[model samples]
Target: MDTTKIEKNFKKLTSSNKIFESVLMIGNASGDFNFTREYKRDIDTPMLMASTTKLLTTTCIYALVQEGKLNLKDELSNYLSKEEISGLHVFKGKEYTFELTIEHLLSQTSGLPDFYLTGTKPVFSKVKDRDFSYSFEEELEWIKHMKARFIPGTKRKAYYSDVNFDLLGKIIEAANASTLQEAYEKYIFSPLNLKHTYLANTESDFIPHTYYKDQRLYRPLFIRSCYASGGGVTTARELMIFIKAFWKGELFDKTFFSKQAQSNPLQMSFYPIHYMGGYMKITASYPFGKKYTLVGHSGSTGAFAFYCLEKDLFIVGDVSQIASPSTGVRLAMRTVLAAE
Candidate 1:
């Protein structure tokens, strides 16, 4: 592949957006055909992954399932106490808390409200003004007062909620008897030899500041509080290795990919994107309006890790801008089209 066009396009993109310190990497499944481009940041620079961290949580959940410690059909009540989950999903005055299952959360069909974006007191808007930490218990408390969108397992229903993955993180701890960070280290980082990928757990953990337009935001407490839903930091190189392994079945059964691929359209805010088993999917239309599927996830902080099934290529990178979450996806699409 002649990379002249790829390099030129990347340079143009960075030049036009001066606040964009970015990295773009492309590789094949077999570890060959590698290409990387950086603007003001190298492949080794760690960046906040935001919601792209959900893919890592999904990997650990699959590992537990393979080990017979978890099952998709298992009820949420199995792992969480009644007091913790009660009143969580009360739609139309019908309590459907116990009706939720591991599959529901993984597929984002639990009808649960998003604590970060929803509710009268949404944390998303407040985070821009101030930095603070909130525990899982606090997040759950916020969800309890919010209204659920639909009933669990409703046909053709899917809502993006950080609370879903946060709950899964708790279930993983209950089933595996280990911390979510430790589980990630064992099932993903250690196995893939990813030295720079980790869940941001403390102030000691270094987290790269992200941009919301021209302003730089460094909310370490907010990032740490996101936990499994979003709190993750990694370099472009390490993220490329992990995403390739995920699609190549190096960590868990690749067969699960088929089941997870039965995606449902998310809310209107996430138009043209679908929710799969803990990941995002977009059928991107390149030049001449030709469409192809890109499987994986993008984060609110302009981070992305995706695999183009039609092209048989893995694309991973970060745009380092919070105001434009879709920038990474557009960049990945352009990179794939440019490589051809």
Candidate 2:
């Protein structure tokens, strides 16, 4: 594949706006056909994974399933105490907290409101002004005051909630009898030989500052608090390895993906993006004329890890800009079109 266009677009976009630093790596399923580009940051620079960490959480969950430690059909109450989950999903005056299943959470059909983006007090808006940390229990308390979007397992309806994966992180711990970080090490990072990828757990973990427009915000406490939902750190080079493993069944059985293949359209704010299992799926057809699908996820910090199925291309990168989360997605799409 001629990467002239890819290189040109990368330089053009990185040099233009709020992107403080950026790195990209594009490659085929095979080891050959590799191309990488960087602007103000090297390929090995550690960057926040943001919501793309959901893919890592998803991989670990599947690993537990393979180990017979958990089941998709298991109830949330089976792992979490009733007091902890009760009144968490009361929609239309009916309590649906006990009705939530692992499948529902994994598929983003749990009707849970996002603590980071929803409620009278959303953490997102305050993130730019200041930096602070809250425990998982605090997050649950925040969500309890919020309203659920729909009933659990509502047909064709999906809401993007960070709490879903946050809950999954708890379930993984409950089932495996270990910390989420340990599970990740055993099932993902260690197995993949990834030295730089890690779940940020403490002030010592070295969480990088993300650009929220022109202001650089260093929220180590908040990033560590993200936990399973979006608290991962990795380099562009390592992310490329993990994403390829994720789609190739190296972390878990690829066949399990078929069960979660059916995707549902998310809320309008996430237009042109769909929720499938634990990741985001994008089907590009309009404007470009050719319909092709990209499977994987994008992050609020302008991080992206996706595979263009038709092109057999794995695209991994980070723009490190929180104000324009979709920047990485648009870049990936342009790279896909350029590769052709």
Give one digit per residue, the lDDT tens place, for model 2 in 1-340. Answer: 7788999999899778778799999999988889999888888899999999999999988888898988899999999999888889999899999999999999899989987766777798999889899999988988888989999998999999999999999999998899999989999999999999999997789898889889988999899999999999999999999999999999898888787657999989888898987888998665858888899999999999999999999999998888889998999888888886
Model 2 residue runs over 4 Å out of place are 286-288
For model 1, give the 10-residue run with minimal summed lDDT.
Answer: 11-20
lDDT of 1 by residue, 241-314 (tens): 89988999999998988775478999998887898888888887765877778989999888999999988989
Q: What is the lDDT of residue 49 in candidate 1?
A: 92
Candidate 2, residue 311: CA error in Å? 0.8
- Can you give the lDDT of residue 162 in candidate 2? 93
Q: Candidate 1, after superposition: displacement of residue 95 in Å?
A: 1.0
RMSD of each: 1.4, 1.1
Clashing pairs in 1: none
TM-score of each: 0.96, 0.98
Error of 2 at 119 (Å): 2.3
Quantify all predictions' global Cα lDDT against the true fold: 0.90, 0.90
